[model samples]
Target: MGNYQIIATAAMGLEALVAKEVRSLGYECEVENGKVIYSGDESAIARSNLWLRTADRIKIKVGEFKAYTFDELFEKTKALPWEKFLPEDAEFPVIGKSVKSKLFSVSDCQAIVKKAVVERMKKYYKRNSWFEENGAFYRIEIALLKDVATITIDASGQGLHKRGYRIDQGEAPLKETLAAALVMLTNWKADSPFIDPFCGSGTIPIEAAMIGQNIAPGFNREFVSEGWNWISSKVWDDARMEAEDLAKYDQPIDITGTDIDHRMVKIAQENAIEAGFADILQFKQMQVRDISTSKEYGVIVGNPPYGERLGEKKAVEQMYKEMGQAFGKLETWSIYILTSNEEFEQFYGKPATKKRKLFNGFIRTDLYQYWGKKPPRQNEMMK
Candidate 1:
């Protein structure tokens, strides 16, 4: 098929990582504030939706222009080649958003954009009857930012994070996308031991297992564009076959997840099973303070309680102190903790070797990294 502009929308603070992933797929990309823009053919859509781990959604950039007034918005949107993408019976729904723009009424923008697209489609299709919209789905979005309107069609219906493995979750569950990002941020290898002391719903450990096995994050999920007639099924079939061929199913991985709550531990185990990592990853019920390992040069990553509520601050601080003491025993194991607590180092009793700012949803958090000395070479360790 012809080349089209594709945009991968990312969570704030993850744009760079998403862009890097796009580049890794052999496509050049431009990193914006909350999205990455790139050019690709029909296959690129399949490949990106299948491979992108940190992105929220993949969309087709139909058109973009500056629109400060309703007239401009309607006219600019109508001028686009909607007929090229949307079929006659396609179910097109318009979603709109306005950020720091003169045309700030989201509902009004949505109505005008919807009317404009319908008008364009009617003129192109040469039909008098209104569209029944009873066929395949096509979700359109009109975003107005700083007097500029960018319109796109959603390729992935549900968010990419819904990998279909998470049947259950805890109260404060970490998103699958963010969990994958946390794993990618580390230097952990598949051969090395990986642990998540606070693996709520087993997101981190399961994600680590997938990464270790070179499994595509979207391997088990379905994308809306897969059924589009414009794109051939061979493109998706080839991409999926490539992903399957690239995965190392027999690769050995040492990954573990633990939680103090027995119920959460059970939930983690269930989620792991659903994710097809039941045999490779181990989940248990244990407190962080009781964590101990004999493995060298291992990695420990966790998303602990941030104690954001006033009543939970003292207890969370104490938990952080205990965690610091427990994890400090592994001199040859690196540790990474994500929390919104600013006084984490003070409670941990040691300064982190490095720290990176990240967002856990809307809450600002820091990934405090404690670098451990690398283990001796294989010969030395074996000696």
Candidate 2:
């Protein structure tokens, strides 16, 4: 296992959370706009791929350089030590994106990078003919932002959000990565009751259940890099074992999800069972306004409808007003709501304690937090 630069790409507005997750895994990282970068060996790659809950994907930073021309791009790309990562029969696909750069043609950039990598591989592997590419897959990317080219090989095959448990979902299902972020941002602890009123497909509750149990988001999935020869099977084995050992499977949690749609409730139940939390998580068909809980010091995190489509604004706003009326009475329960609607607080009847801007996919949204009063210390009570 050789030391290499690693990049954990995250959604916009989630770089800090991703960086925090990386650091918690015992690796130092620098948080960028949409990425957290660090250096680590194979174990770092494997562990990050398995443990990073908030990242979109883990990438191995191949090389970065300034490229103003096609020739410069090809030469600099070829100069990187591709042989160290790519085997003789590795299947390398070049995908590219160019932004505010002289190399404005993405297809040309990808083609040039591919040709350059092939040329480099031929020279290093001593091959006369073209590569058979019958072995491990290496999806390479060339990103040019302001004339700087950063190349990386994808380590997580599908996005990390594809936790492989969702057999069904609603029309607008929230990404698991974003769902986990919503849970992590709340004041809810494993011992406290957690609820998602508008839990479409039950993503929030399932993610909360996993978090409450200290389960690795990637524990049940496989990564693209797991097929690479350079990274030993033992590396992945060790990472999995570490995940297994660190999990709090026996921990008790009170998590619930309710949706207005009965079909969505059924789907959520199926997905939870698929995610191995059938008994740990509860789901039901319920409306937001009717949500009444006796549990104090709990947290309510919800991703309600943004009413972005036509004619839905009126109904959604009414629902929001009802949510305000319902949730406002629970003074001991903190509430967090994610919505793109700017008038959310106005309709919800109270201003947020604090607001954090976040993007749900491409839609700009804000997390409106209502902090609840803290629970009294045991000694503060009458003796």
Candidate 3:
């Protein structure tokens, strides 16, 4: 198969992480503004859609050209070989999203690209087709940055973040992709004990379990490219096989989640069971202040409840103080907390050694990392 350029889209502040994910698949990736551009064939696209845990979507760069005007955009887009990617009777949906550029009209660009693709498609099918699409769909994102239009075809149908395990969602629950990214950002080894004290619906703990097992986040979803005529069934089958084979052995890792609410614990357990890591996780109904365990060399990570939902300022302050006390008890464990409240570090009484900006839905959050004392030199080598 001929080589093709592809773009893996990711959320803001995660370009580096997503680039690592792309490169792990043996693709040459360049981290751009909000996406990673890579060179790969059709198989690579399929593999990424099925295995990338940090990316939002995988898109094939079907066309690229300068589009200062509508005519230019239409002509350049029409030049692409639509027949190669889409069948004669295949249903197509041109989903357009524009960023900073001269040709910034989303509706106009959408119309131009749709018309151009349809015009090119007709030559292959010998029919002037202009009917409402149904069934299968391909989202086309048109990014006109600095007057240069980069047209991409979405290979993944829904976002890769929507791992099917999350059947129950609590208020302000972390997204599966974001949860996975937060864990990956820690660079925690599989041997470390991972725990989430304020796990709401078990996203962080479940994601950690999946990572320790090296399971693909897209293991349960169907990609849009699987329905494309250009992508063969054998190719998809091979991709699935590769993903399954890459899935690492289930290590005897200690992963746990605790929530003040017993109902949340039940939901988390259900999520873990659905994610196929039930045996590796333990969910308990415990408050942050009451957590007493003997696990050493573990990492405590969580998106604790914050803001108005956490009640008045006094209550929130008490929660944060107790969270700090919990961290203090784990003399050899590292703690990573994601919170939107600016006073969180103050309440903890110690500044984070490291920090990163992340988005938890529309609200921006700061992922802070606090480390306890390192283990004795002899203990490190004892293993």
Candidate 4:
């Protein structure tokens, strides 16, 4: 348990951000397609499961094999120690995903693995008893890629994006994972003010409040690893204790959110209260053109509606132009807007300093960032 390798799964285009998060957690990581691999001890795994904001889940790769056929898959899966993780009375089920492989039938592979696990457990326990049970302590997923299979034990049962605060979501709600990534992309600190002008459902402000207060994003939920037989109850207790200790920094951080829809503003207020950050954020109903910028320095990060469930293209363009007019007044504030519209820069009246690809679910979007400064010359010296 002292040495382990784990995968921090992330949304599709934010793999690099997930790697950065892993490294920030004081561990070395290798970035791969839609995932980051890192090494740590048991405690580090617990901490990462509790603290990582941009990841979808933390998975423990249990076994790997070159399984091109059902026999090979069964033999390989049966070789692992299944009884060590599952209790004697625990009811387990398997989920399988296969891609670009000879064993492409997902159901077939799933059935094979399930049979292997059951056989191994029966032999290990030396009992001929097997019964169907409704729930289990853990759920396992097997993924097969080009002639290779990897077995992963899910550490976080429900996706980490379900931070347990957003009970009411308006149409086209942005995921909590992407919202946190938007906050981090701003490179914001606790000293700076943060606001989301088009803040729908208050995802941006709640995530900002969590980040500014150094709160662990997973503190409000349960993990599948907590019920595993191999882990001691003391480990979870220590993890919770450490998370509770980390959440003590609750000073006001000047976080605010506003939306044009009064109903959305009320929902945002309710979400903030549910997340226990109502005191740290101010929610209001205001149009984008009426946004006031009294602060000299801050970050405006948000995901505006891009003609998807909101309105037509021309209307959205006009709305964006008004937003640009409002944001142009803040010369000292950096702006990061996530949108699927490529012509957004035309409305903003300035080229973006940087652009990163991000996905709002299946929709392709770009995070356009405008730093409030010009690029320094290559050979220029500091003053």
Best by lDDT: 2
Model 4 lDDT per residue over 1-383, tens place: 75666899999988888888888879999998888998887777788888899999998877888998899999999999776666677767789999899999999988999889988988988878784544455677889989899898788888889999997989889999999999988868878888898888999899988888889998988888877666677888898898788775756698889999999999999999999977778998998889877786788997988876545888888888998888888887889999999999998787898999889999999999988642255226544
TM-score of each: 0.97, 0.98, 0.94, 0.94
TM-score of 2: 0.98
With candidate 3 superimposed using the best TM-score fit, by how many Å does residue 276's alpha carbon deviate from the native?
1.3
Ranking by lDDT: 2, 1, 4, 3
Q: Mind giving the per-residue lDDT tens digits that candidate 1 earns over 1-383?
A: 78999999999889999999999999999999999999999999999999999999999999999998999999999999999999999999899899999999999999999999999999999987799999989999999999999999999999999999999999888999999999999989999999999988999999999889999999998999997989999999999999999999999999999999999989999998899987888988999989998888999999999999889999999999999999889998999999999999999999999999999889999999998877668548877
Question: What number of backbone clashes does candidate 1 have, counting pairs of residues 3 or more apart or in separate chains?
Answer: 0
In model 3, pairs of residues that clash are none
Candidate 3 C-alpha lDDT tens digits along 101-215? 8877888898899898888877777886564556456777677778888888888888898888988979778888899998998857798788889988999998888888888
Which residue runs does candidate 2 get wrong by more than 4 Å? 378-383
lDDT of 3 at 227: 86
- Between candidates 2 and 3, the lDDT winner: 2
Pairs that collide in candidate 2 are: none
